[model samples]
Target: MNEVAVVKNQILDVEISDLINNGMGLVKINGYPIFVKNALPEEKVQIKITEVKKTYALAEVLVIYQTNPYRVTPKCKIYDQCGGCNLQHLSYKYQLMMKTNFVKEALVRIGKLDVKVNDCIGMQDCWKYRNKTQVPFGVRNNKVIAGFYKENTHEIINMDTCEIQDALADEIVNYMKFLAQKYSIPIYNETEHKGNLRHIIIRKAHVTKEYMVTLVTKEDKLKNENKIIDDLVNKFPQIKSIVQNINPQKTNTILGDKQKVLYGDEYIIDYIGDVKFAISSKSFYQVNPIQTKVLYDQVLKYAELTGNETVIDAYCGIGTIGLYLAQKAKAIYGVEIVSDAIKDAKLNAKLNNFNNAHYEVGKAEDIIKKWQKENIKADLIIVDPPRKGCDSSLLDTIKTMKIPHMIYVSCDPATLARDLNILSDTFNIIEVQPVDMFPHTSHVETVVLMSRK
Candidate 1:
């Protein structure tokens, strides 16, 4: 430990010892932990303390005296300023290693379970894997700006291309910005609570090569809408759906309740492992279709369906995982809180002719408790909860039902470990698999298999 006094706005030299869960580099100055962004482990750097706290201090790296061997040059020019991807500076191989360790560490430290965690499933070509793009529209220096938000700020970093998103989506966004400028469209200002255009969201299907363009605006109407639509349709022949989402509120939420089809259909079609799905403007589809298949396939393998088992897919969004498993299971009951998602799930089930599959719109925990009282039983349960992980009530319901097996899909490793700890008494951890759903980000998705003890 160095004898330097730790104070706010003080510049000090430090050695990065480790990386935290959010991809920030960790260094200690005078026996106090300091977190520095854009720094790497095993590197000596000079940092300026931005804030001083009792537990830990936050700092920004000023200079690197020694660099890590695994550090690489990020492809995106705005990678340092954009909040999209954090691990873009780290080598791809090291990113995979860190993610694999993330799962193992969570299981050991939080779950208190010493289990085998397999190496993370990585992409062959990590760039341009995202199938969706949501670019915020704004104005800077009297010019239309559209791109991602700056790190920890609402300011947009105007970008013509993004290494992670599909190239066509970037092109569409640039074109939208160009048209907004050409028509002199007013850009929404959050502070003033005025203007019309807000965001431009683009979605693409890999197998079908179809595209959906959704223009999110502050009002229900758009200026020069017909011309913009005609231009977009003529330029992109693959565009299947063009829609407008009206978000009149002054809040930060992107999509509003009302959506209108400006041209073409209201929804686009896509497939995931032979299961066709109709994706609407508000549908919750995985951004990475390639890794989603890998994640879901692991879920199916862990499910071990025998053609006679009844399974409950909790928090089933659009019935993607449930419909995939419906091929081998006797029956599938999917539960979701979103009514629109439930409707889409039912439509997908009907389209696929999976009469044995059923979907209900309700809180997953409440529905599970109701089913328990009604004497309905499930041989296995698959839960793909949000980053917060499974609710306590749902975990209790799972314990009460004593399902023979469970497949837990989690985006946040810490939450997954916490939930696994809560159910450790009832279930035994069999194995864990970490999937690199977002290649250049600190986030890692994991799938766990647990069997009744």
Candidate 2:
């Protein structure tokens, strides 16, 4: 519990020994860990301490004396400042290797369970893979600016394009920015919380080429709504839907309860492996469509359905996973807390003629408990929880229910490892597959299959 002997503004030369979870490199001085931004492992770099905490300190890389062979020049112009893509400086091949190692390390160090983690499945064309883009609107120097925020701050980093986002999204955002400026649409002010426009969220279907534009605003109305819609429809012929979301609050949260359809339908159709989905303005569809199919296919494989088992999908947002597995299972029961997503899920199930798939609006744990009390049994359970991993109550229910098979799709390796350790007592870890859903970033999606012992 002793404080590290590090002070602010101190300069020291250190060799990066490892990369941490947040994509920062780690170096130890007197056995005290110091995190250096934009530093690579096995590279010796000169770092300047910015802040010193009780146990660890944060530093910025000043100069790289020795560069790792995997290091590459970042393609982004504001790579040093923008926090959107963290591992762009590292080679794509090494980025996959590092992400695989990150999962393995989390399992071994945190879960204390040594398991074989497969090599990360990367996309052939990693760049321009994102199907969605949500850019905030802000004003800097009396001019409208729209882009991702800077690292660890709300300050917008003005940019023309993003490497990962779909090209159409970039075009739509830029065009919206131009129209906003020309029409004198006021940008939202986070400080005073008084403005008109807040964010521009664009979602594109990779296979369909259909586009949905959602203009997030402070109030329910836009200044020149009709003219703006006319201009947008005239320019973007591929735009299938245009909507306005009103967030009349003083908080930083995007999207509000009220929404109005400006033009076209309220939803845009998208597909993943022949499974159609209706994506609304606030739908929780995957950003990477290609890799999403890969991830879902892996889950289906791990489920090992033999066409007679009943499967339960927890946190089944929009019922994508359950609907994907519906053909293989006898019956699929999906549960989600969000009512909007549940509504979409039910609609999607009917759209696809999936009569066996049923969706309900409720917490996964509470619904599962109710099902268990009603003598409904799940042969297999699919959990695609958020970064915090499965809730303890859900874990307990799964353990008590003794589901034969469990497929866990995790976005955070640390939490997945922790949850896996807790469940290891009853289930045997069969295999772990890491998928590079978000390339050029430290975040990885892992699919783990566990069978009851």
Candidate 3:
């Protein structure tokens, strides 16, 4: 990577490749794809090349002397540092437009499908939409450090307050510092591989207005466990649940092992629409509640399941969407790969008292095949896969089964486009709706409704 002086370089006018999704502008400078971060299309500005390679150059916004009308001041101080939200600097309406174009670009470039995507479904409040946040702790400057790292770097930027997360979440960080100082629990160190605190994942229930604080660290790290849990429960009665996770490994992953409940309920319960779900620390619940409600409603509306139609919810975690629509359908079968998630889903079904909804613990594709062998037929199927999106085998199974109505919820549009290209022969895309699940970032969640001809 060579250092190129972009500001004073006497180069010709560089034409942007338009918004190539992810809120980045592409330009083939020197026959290489130069990715300019925080850049807008059709807008010319001098950029500072941070890293110049033979193929592409990574740059930062140096002199946007000419600003686009869509650009707005970033509300969060950690806008450029924390990778949590990228589009916050841009206006809400502009954010909506950028996301709308993102989906359109994916369809045109990746899927090669001439599909008409509607305007992105915007949220009521983009900030403070997150109901949960997992703040990581790493050692830096010779002590415990708490904050998010710079984008694409291991360096952590200490933040006094995070605008994207709820104000209570910010307070929790400060409160934990007081307790950590009082209890003398050392924070985790990535370089030296020594420290006590690893992560603090705070879960908030919207309806209940209760909070669940789960402290994750080594099993034997907490010296005075009972006293601390008692102190937390007593001090913060609103803290409905407290959990201690034992994870001794060295990884940046989320889940932990051997959770020991210190106080309050075992799991936190929350509602989405009309259905209630049991949420564990490891459960993959939607981070944004406002947009998730819209996402699920769109799923049900697209399904159009009659009271007599049977619905199958593949990859249903905790049965949030499936259980809500269970009563409308004749029978709802929810399949999940994680057994713990399946257990919680079953409990949620029991909690909702919906005898029509059933949950099975197995891979989405594997369980669907097994159910096919058991002579199971579904009139409607809804799949909300992880970020990597659904695989070919799953799409192939859907095509072979020929499900009449299919609603696919995807967080990654590139993979969604790839899968849609594969399923285009049998199904005509009726409509595609982009949901603003994550408002600040370039990432957008899309729901594609397809009906078989």
Candidate 4:
């Protein structure tokens, strides 16, 4: 086999059962349930081991011994390599079912939370629904390549078409490709690091039906970009803003310190229900707008906010959730560590005229500790920490504050469960709901509601 190393483990054939984290079908392998990244339950498959860990070893599906009746071929040509979308091969219904069960499993097994989890809020259109995408630019085979990095590696998989992104995004990539060919703008090389092009951040306004392109890099090769943008605007007609984020950092971070507008407005406004949000390339926003609306609606329902109650939104990135929940509460306090995000939150609140929503830029734990010193009370607190979950100190501070109601929005169930377990000591989890914010990917966005015991 082309000198590829092979290790044989005589794993017993077990019924394809249960999806563990990362879209793997968990089955007993030598009395231990292991995750197989590309497999679903009910499919008989052979796994090739890659790494052995203490609890679970990572493996890839080598062959499908027998395909499940539910198995459907993935529609995307680059589905396997793109890494953005998992479960792209699975049916939409199956995606919803697994995502719903994922939340239930986390709550019941880890948190010991005897809570009723509602069915996952699924999307109407599973394909090409993402509103925003960040495509990296790399050079390979003497050609500039703009696409997502391979699943876990820095190597860019040269691509012009991606099914998960809005079909227009692919078209825009193609347009950029043509523009590069005509203008001879060199593609950024990761190894050589000498190209003007670095990344492309594309966002489409749902309300205005307008698109904005944020070209991210240190140098701009598209001289007279205003004319180019005007040409693009004339052609596309729907494009509102074309901007360049001049970032030279050799990291994966999006947006640069300096931003220059090439055409039209500086920022495109996005609307979620009655509130309008101004989004920039630097601002953090949920990629899936439709599902995020559903997720926020679920949050609103669970929060049961009254105009007289005070609420605190922890880790409030750009204050979207707090802004969404602001009108219903008397006073909404948003705490964010990122100064830029806090600035965005305040701007968003002011833009939407949510006079009651106030934001402060500081770490959550520090804010909670200080607020506790002043005897600040919140009827509700929303915590949406990163995937690693909240730190123990933050959790301890949260406990110390003794907020009456807590809403935890998590992207990782394992961490969510771990945090919930600690929180369960003083709070009783009342509701658990999973929202498929990222369709196709193994990732899940879940919200847990807790009330003080």
Candidate 5:
């Protein structure tokens, strides 16, 4: 084993060599790796060791003698306190570069694939692009405070606005906080597991300019529901849905199984290109609608559908991607584990007036095999899975099916690499395109086109 050169709480000066996936700077002391927060590559900084593990030590910047050229002042006042946007200090150009590099490095190091990654596609106007905002409500010093949670803790960093969230949504969040105070609504305490209101979630449809507010509470009953609805609707004439979600459990999950419509409709309408989606409080629509179209357009370009090919959409939530491509394909079959999402998918298909779209509720791994047994083949398969990536059984099923063309949409590069490595035996990667779906953050979205060998 290598000798340790740093001790906990020890202050030392080091030159940063590179940045890790989470935007932390990495430095080496006697060939031992140390991670320093807020330190940039090629920079010299004084840091105090906060933690020392077997192979690595964690540190925080004390003073920076040299800084990277791309570093900039963070826009958010609580950029260091709030954990929402980590790369705000990095210039937008460098943020795109870092995300592209993240995908390329993950492919080579984790997936062991020799593939070229394209530069990340960025938005012209990245701020105020998020269509959804979920903020937890807490009472600090007998006053209601709402915003993002502080880093590494449940403490709330109260803010009136966020750089990435929609401006109107931020306004609605502040209004809700005001109403909570006016009505004396008890804020849920995670420790004591008491109180009434827990979180305030706001959603906006960029295309339709409609809004939805969902109040997550520890109980079904709400204080001054009528006045709250009347005041919010009167204040924001764009609001189309006012909802209350009952989350009686003492857990950390935000939404509950039961939801009630306090006023207006239960859902709001949104559009990506020509395809429309009905977004409920529980729907899994992308937060950034403008970039969602860009990502989907990339998928469409890769698919090159001829309007006569069967397309299988796996892990299809609300039929967003599949429905986007439905008009170009002969038929679309979508499978999801959530029955509600499948129902929404079917509803969205109807909303789009696409008769060729079919949806079923089941695991993708199991459904694909069932389709194979029924001799229902797909000319193209698209999988947009969670961060954990595709199930091993699903990958094996894809291998057995040997679909001619496939597209992998991933939010996590590491998992995308692992799955691509497994599929490499049967598919040849044509290209990879990363989209800046969430700006000023370490997260990235990638689309890969693969052809069966």
Candidate 6:
């Protein structure tokens, strides 16, 4: 083991060797690595040690002796303080390359699989692509402000516009802040657990141009609720739905179980390709609908539907993917744990007039077993688990079922590799496609196709 050489506040000039998944630069001193922020690979930088640990240390870039050619000024003014976009300084071209490498590295290092990873599919226009914006409300200088929280802290960054979010969303957030101040809406304090409003969420449908606003609060009673709702509707006629989600608990979760539709319908409509969906306050739809089509197109291509195969969609949120593939398949059975999502999924299926799609609300692993007992045979199975990846039991069930073909969609590369390693014994890796769902951020979405050998 190497002895600790770097101390707190120690300054040193180092050459960055590589970039980690979080876009942090790797600097080695005496065989020990230090992670530096705002530093790029192949650049010489002077850094100050922020924190030191046994194996690794954390650093902040003090001065760049030599900067990378791809580095550019961040577009957002609050990019340094706000923690939303991590790769704004890096060029979008290199950002795609880095995300491709992120997926390739995970497959080789974590999954122990030597496979070829295709280049990441990116958007032509990445800015202002996000359809949903959720900003926390806080009291700054005795006035209400709304924006994203600082990195690893609860303090909100007061900003009127975000480059990545829809322009209309920015206008709505600023106006809502003004309305909150006028109405004297109380801002919730995590420490004291007082006040009424906690956060404001706005979701816009890119295809339909329809919008939905959800206010998260500590209580149901709001000051001048009718006036505020009326003012918002009149100000933004595109806003078809306004909802209030009540979360009286003192926790970090954003939305509560109980909700009330303040004005208009409870759900708004959105489309992915030809499939239409009714998105509610809690439904888990993809933020980037443009790249989502590209991603699902890859899934459909890999599935190679011939109108004879029965498909199963595990972790299907609102039956988006299954419904997207429902046209060419014999039947589609989708399972999700969220009851609200299941309700939306059923509603979306009906909206699209697809009677072949079936949705169930339960743990996918348990539901798969029940389906297996009922002699429900599926030709293909698709699992799009969360960042934590699929459950071990669910993987075991998939292996046991011996599904001929499988498609695994993942948002986290590390977890995707772990789950793929478990399924490698029974499935042969066919192809891995990386999609740049969230630009100017470290997150990447991947879709992998596997076949029974």
Q: Give the C-alpha lDDT of model 3.
A: 0.79
What's model 1's lDDT at 152? Answer: 81
Question: Per-residue lDDT of 1-453 in model 5, one digit per residue for the tens?
Answer: 667879999999889998888879999888889998888899989999999999888999999998899999999989999989888989999999999999999999999998999999999998988998999999888889999889889989999989999888898899988999999988899999999999988899989999999999999899888999999999999999999999999897899999999989987999999998999999888999999999999999999999999999999998999999999999999999999999899999999999999998999999998998988889999999999999999999998896899999999999999999999999999999999999988899999999999
Query: TM per model?
Result: 0.97, 0.98, 0.93, 0.91, 0.98, 0.98
Badly placed stretches (over 4 Å) of model 3 are: 1-17, 139-144
**Alpha-carbon runs more than 4 Å astray in model 2:** none
Candidate 4 clash pair list:
86-440, 86-441
Question: Per-residue lDDT for 366-452 in model 6, tens only?
Answer: 999889888899999999998999999999988888789999999999999999999999999999999999999999999999999
Q: How far is candidate 6 from the true structure (C-alpha RMSD, Å)?
A: 1.2
Better of 2 and 5 by lDDT: 5
What is the lDDT, from 0 to 100, of the residue 87 in candidate 1? 92
lDDT for model 5: 0.93
Model 4 lDDT tens row, 1-453: 123222445343445677876777776655555667778788888776676655566667878888776678988788778777778778888888888888778877987777788888878887777888678876666666788888889888877777777777777876775666566666666566677777887888776667888887667455646555765677677778888888777666666688888777877899888888888767888888888899899889988986888898899999999889888999888899899898888889999888998788898988877877888788999999999899899889888777889999999988998899998888888888888888887788998888999
1-453 per-residue lDDT for model 3 (tens digits): 443434323333454556656667776654557677777766676766667655566766666655667778898877777776767767889888888888888888889999999999988777787889777776555555577878888777776687777778777766776677677788777566677777888888877778889888855558677877777777777788888887787777655667877678888888888788788777878888778889989988887877998888998988888987986889999999888888888889899888988889988888888777787889988888887788778888888886888888888888888888888998999999999888778888999999987
RMSD values, in order shown = 1.8, 1.0, 2.8, 3.6, 1.1, 1.2
lDDT scores of the candidates, listed in order? 0.92, 0.92, 0.79, 0.80, 0.93, 0.93
TM-score of 5: 0.98
